[model samples]
Target chain A: MAALGFGLAYAGFLGLCLAMDRHHAELLRGRPAAGRRWLLRGVGWLLLGLSLLPCLALWGVGIGIVAWLGLLTVAAYSLVHLIPYAPRLALWLGPLLPLAGLALSLAPT
Target chain B: MKQGFRQCMAWLHTWSGLLVGWILFAVFLTGTASYFRGEISDWMRPELHAPAAGGEPAILAIETLKRLAPDSPTWFVFPPGERNSELRVVWRNPPGKPTPPGSRGFGNMVLDPATGEPVTARESYGGEFFYRFHFQLHMPPLWGRWVVGFCAMMMLVAIISGVITHRRIFADFFTFRPGKGAGRSWLDAHNALAVLALPYHLMITYTGLITLMLMYMPWGVQAVYKGDRGGFQAEVFGVAPPVRRANQPAPLAPVGPLLEEAMRRWGGPPGRIEVQQPGDASAIIRLTRRDSEQISSNPQTLTFDGVRGTLLGASGEPGAAAATRGVAYGLHLGRFASPLVRALFVLSGLAGTAMVATGLVLWAAKQRHRHARAGRAGFGLRLVEALNLGTIAGLPTAMLGYFWANRLLPLHLADRADWEVYCFFLLWGLAALQALFWPGLRSWATQFAAAALLGLLLPVLNLLTTHRHLGVSLPAGDWAMAGTDLLVAAFGLLLGLLSWRLFRRAGRAPVTRPVRGAGLARAEGA
Candidate 1:
């Protein structure tokens, strides 16, 4: 569950980064269209909000919120470091991470 | 007007951060290490290598304290728990009595829970040194805390003014151009580090002040309690007045039942057991709920009549104001966090340390560039550069030296614990001398290389000196020992890479470029 929360946060931040003109140019090799930018922005905000569900389930309300904030920091920092050095890899990892997290969640203990 | 206001804020942020940046670096680095203080202490004491014993730690601790300090007025027993494996105890001396040798009106011992006997480990302060140095900086308690408190206030100012000055905070949120020139690159690194962990930095700084609030701002207590600080503490913290000794020596009731009852009541294990006047008719036993059980550092204690073994009373839930303070204190200490959350806390702490490190280096890099353009380095720039190198590189080298001294120092050496601390200062002083004589890129490389060597060699030293090496510990599933060795070596590798980079750079002529975004960088005070 914690892993899922972290993955969703990373994916969310990646979406937001793709919506930015500079990062979009660097990662996707072209400027984002107006509609595409808005779509990415909406999906980014929605994913970030969705990340909270796993956190709230993992820890209770009080600590869960704190955990969510911390995860966001980690996720954003991770994206920042990765995007500067490995833009394509950073983009690929966003979708891959959530899928990996989903696989782990379904696996038996 | 807005530009002028931001310029003013940038100036404030620069000086506020630079003036005490060295001290803040040390505090942050040491404080980050303190999150694992218990594990560090456990790793230091290799003699107590046996796994957790089957015996109840509370029973063993009580028996040991009974025999050791029979006549002491009060005793505090901390039974083995998740963080620590040793049953530790401390006892206060009777009033007006001469303290025993090597003790200052109090005595403490670490007992192995398996045997209820004192663990004859080599004398060392262990992780408690780093924990104490985090806030106190090894000075007299009052002076050290006040100095740290003042720096924390400056850090708070720097954070706020920095945010105000950085106009492109969101636009540059995911931006970090390490390939850029020295000034630009350092600025980017500093900004990224600071912005990424901004919430942690804010929380930690505010709560750090709150931790020592009483000393820093006692006006509230004075106004409310007529300067009777003790009374205020008693009322706010629910500390019952001390029970007088009845002079009639009586047997202390068995603590086993009381321990069980307290556990049943709290639904969790108690962290500390305090017995007041343990051998007298007026004796009282107080059990404090463990810190890990809640997000409040405040103690929720249940008191019992010591002689009769009957429940006397339990402390009520704290008032809202007190509870808020407790949560703040707990958040700063992070004792309630689980392992995963604790790791996140450590990551944030490292980011904070890196932010300060990058900021200090950025100041020097900018000044050096300016001096190059002016044809010579001025006295102020030179001084700041030397201080920056000495503290940022030298402190870590000194800390690693302290750990080495722990393993190498002879067991029977007099005042062995104090000697370990002296070694730390001695190495740091040497590094400072080196920086003073030659404050250049070469000096930076030398100190970093030294730090790298010390850190990398620690695990090998452990293997040679003690049986509790990675070979033995990893196989035995002793994560504390294995983790320490692995983490130190990892840090060593990082320092090595840094040293190599500095060495390579030092071999070439210094370059001075008109910093790109010089205006924004200066305005942001990076």
Candidate 2:
């Protein structure tokens, strides 16, 4: 569950970053302001928020929060650096991550 | 004298970090290993590999105590936790009891709870040595803590100043180029690690100081507690220590029932059992809950009258201030973390160690670059190089030596633990001497190769000595043993790779780069 949370969080953060004018132009071959930036931002926030569910499901609230934050930091850092080298992979990852996370979360413990 | 604040911070960060960099590296490495301290201890004591009894440990402990120390004033029994496999028992004399001059005030031994027999595990320091060395450096207790506390303060300063000095920290977070000139590569590595885990670094350092807050800054505690350290402890932990033992003799009640009661009250198994005045009329038993069930490090304990197995009372609940302190200690110790999170903690610690190592190397590389332009290096650069190699590579090599000594040394040798520790220091000293004498890339490769050799072959040695190889351990589900061997092998591979890299780079002349800002010579030359 925590692994799923980390995956979803990383994906969500990547989506939000790509939605920005700079990252969008660099990675998507589009005007930075052209994509549904607000929509991406909104979805990113929702996914990031939703990632906490798996964490809370695994560990109780206090430890879950700590784990979630740690996962968030690790994911955000990795996604930021990963975007430059594999922009296409990074773009695809933003959507595929939550699906993978969902599959992992529903798997029998 | 008229430098900008950022430049001043840069200067402070470099010097302060460099000054204590070696010690900090040692502290970080040992501290990182300590996250698996219990498992390490288990691996070191191969003889204590008996399968679990799957019976009530409380009953086993009571039976063992009855046979071993029937009249001892106090008996402390520690059942195996999720990681440990041995039950530990300690018997202590009452207050004012006469003791040998060098006695530790108690006698303790590991027991196979199944047979209720004392374990004949080899006498070695085990993981406790690394845990202690993290903060104590194995020196006199007070001085060790003082030294560690001072280094921690310097570490905090270095972290803060480092952030201030790295003006392009955010911009450079994505700018790691590994195959560049030595200085740039080292700087990039240091910056990436430091920034990537910046929050963890800051939190660990700050909480490390907090763990020893009373010793480092005792004025507030002293004033509030009126210098009564015992009182302060009692209030914080809420343990109502037993009074003097009554001389009247009385048999101890069955501990199993009391343990069951404690588990019921605490909603979990009791982590530890402390028996006070075991054979006296006023005996008491205290049961503390396991740390895994809570975020705070402080265990909630319940006390019972030992004679009738009746509940005396529970310990005091921690106040807000005490709870905050407990949280800080918990975060630093991370005893409550699951296996995955604990592994993460170890990674962060390794990252911290890497950060310190790179910072030290960066300083040396820059100086060498600056001095090489003048056709020679200075004494300071040479010294830093030797020290860096000695510590960065030497420490791990020494650790490997310690493990080798455990396996190779005579099992019946007296003071075996001391000898094991001596081997560690002796190897470390030899590495330092080798570095000093042979100084350069050749020495680096040699030291790294030696460490690699020792680390990679430790499992084979263990197999030869105890017949407990990974082949046997892995299939048998003895993870603690197999895991240790596998990790050591992985570390060995890393060192081997590093040794190969150094060997390849050895032939090239020092790579000299332009000195920037104040001629700090902070760029890599070779």
Candidate 3:
């Protein structure tokens, strides 16, 4: 349980750090996009929420299946939505992936 | 031809990849199966099945090691992991030494838990065979690995060029429309799995390549130093201690105390033990941890002086290349990690197989128009088409037959178990031949029918042969045997449905292609 929690938290922490890093980089370069920033924040909150969910014992299984579906669906969605620019799509989703998989794995059952 | 460099490379990448993709798929599938090697061994050998080793392994280890290998160079005990329980002990015997019949593994023996006597289970090289086979297959050693490594290299190039070639990767994701044209659906499945798991595909391929990079690129070592493969291995892996002939041929250290110390220190007993120079000048014992179920790799090894039991340095203290290799191996195995990680890996592996299958079908679909236009379409195109058919459809047919063979073959036949697996490859090879001769649609329908019939019949075959069928097994919750039977039946039913559809489709069209060339070149039976 501790391993699962630590893994989820570490993954969530990494995603938040990377998202913030990218977001801050955009701001530093004077390419401030509020929409993208909001997206990053949304991702961060999602990670934070997922990271904490392992702490809740009973809901782990239901949450895990949902998380699996959610990660897969999101991956499929992101891939489909990002047309022509395969590299860009990969770059954005690649780092998020370890998190997606790790978070999904934390769910019980 | 200067204008065709990019095209030539692309062609090379595609053809080389397509040629081995099916085999690679089999390799990956079987390789993944081996992650549960110990459990699979337990499942196969119902007798050796202990209750997941309910007790503290200290006593078991002390007892088993003392009883089993008191005279050997090193006594090793792999005392169960998260996924598998049932302690296994290994001892090295020389090549010429008489090996008892039914010994599944080479060089080592697994002790019977009850008597701690070297015993034979049902013939299973178990997951180890698949692991060793995945890279080179069970072919003649280095040559086999080279062949597999070359194919993996081709795969690496194929992945890169495939990404380059796909113009609508994103647009096609989530677009799999069933009962739509086979080509379109294949494309959607391919794009969705590939593009979505792009990093995984990339990482797995790259890491796979790196895993055997030294073997492939042997020139660098040849140029730098004397070409001693063993020396290179020792230097690079650095995990194995340098050989020393133990003067006076002294007695070896006991394993129980070391294993006790190791389990206490690391909460798990060693996964394996290495003995350097069995009866020589400098013999040593190394105990390897069966790494935690974390996604990260690191199965630590504690080396001790064989005679005096002097504590040598631990292998996985974070800074060494051996540690790096340990993690790499762990990641590849996906066994050391938690069950959740393994489940994810299995899912990913399945997705990868789907990704490859869908890609082949899509490529065939896209080329349909081109083949239609080119009246000059000759053996090459026809060969590729048949190969795609054989691999995509026939491998499963062969696999279903393998399970059936297990049930159908006489239980008492000498070497029956190994031969059953051999029958799998043999039948699959025949399926390739069948794919070549039969019309593509007929081949698809026939093979699917074969898979369905064999898979569904497997349960009945078991009942006839072993008197153990799913209905009785499942009610009793004998999950391993019964579950396997049920799943095979279920898969068979699914294949039966597929066969019905393919048969219906076959009736609708007189699809024609060039005479097949018996394209087993891509039929890699991993």
Task: Identify the candidate with maximal DockQ.
Answer: 1
lDDT of each: 0.86, 0.81, 0.60
lDDT of 2 by residue, A19-53 (tens): 76667677787755544887787888888998898
State each candidate's clash count: 0, 5, 11
Docking class of 1: medium
Best candidate according to lDDT: 1
lDDT of 3: 0.60
Rate residue B91 of model 2 by lDDT.
Answer: 86
Clashes of 2: 5
Which candidate gets the maximum TM-score versus the true structure?
1
lDDT for each residue of candidate 1 in B122-145, tens digit (9 for 90 to 100): 888989999999999999999999
Writing each residue's lDDT as its tens digit, candidate 1 over A1-109 gives 8888889999999999999999999999889999999999899889899889888998788677777888999999999999878888899999998888778777897
List ranges where model 2 is wrong by over 4 Å. A12-50, A76-97, B1-3, B95-101, B507-526
Candidate 3: stretches off by over 4 Å: A1-109, B1-13, B51-75, B84-88, B94-107, B171-174, B177-179, B223-225, B228-256, B275-284, B292-299, B305-312, B316-324, B373-377, B456-497, B507-526
Model 3 fnat value: 0.12
For model 1, name the residue pairs that clash: none
Candidate 2 chain B least-lDDT 10 residues: B514-523
**Predictions in order: chain A TM-score:** 0.97, 0.88, 0.38
Q: What's the DockQ of model 1?
A: 0.77
Ranking by DockQ: 1, 2, 3
Better of 1 and 3 by DockQ: 1
Q: What is the TM-score of chain A in candidate 1?
A: 0.97
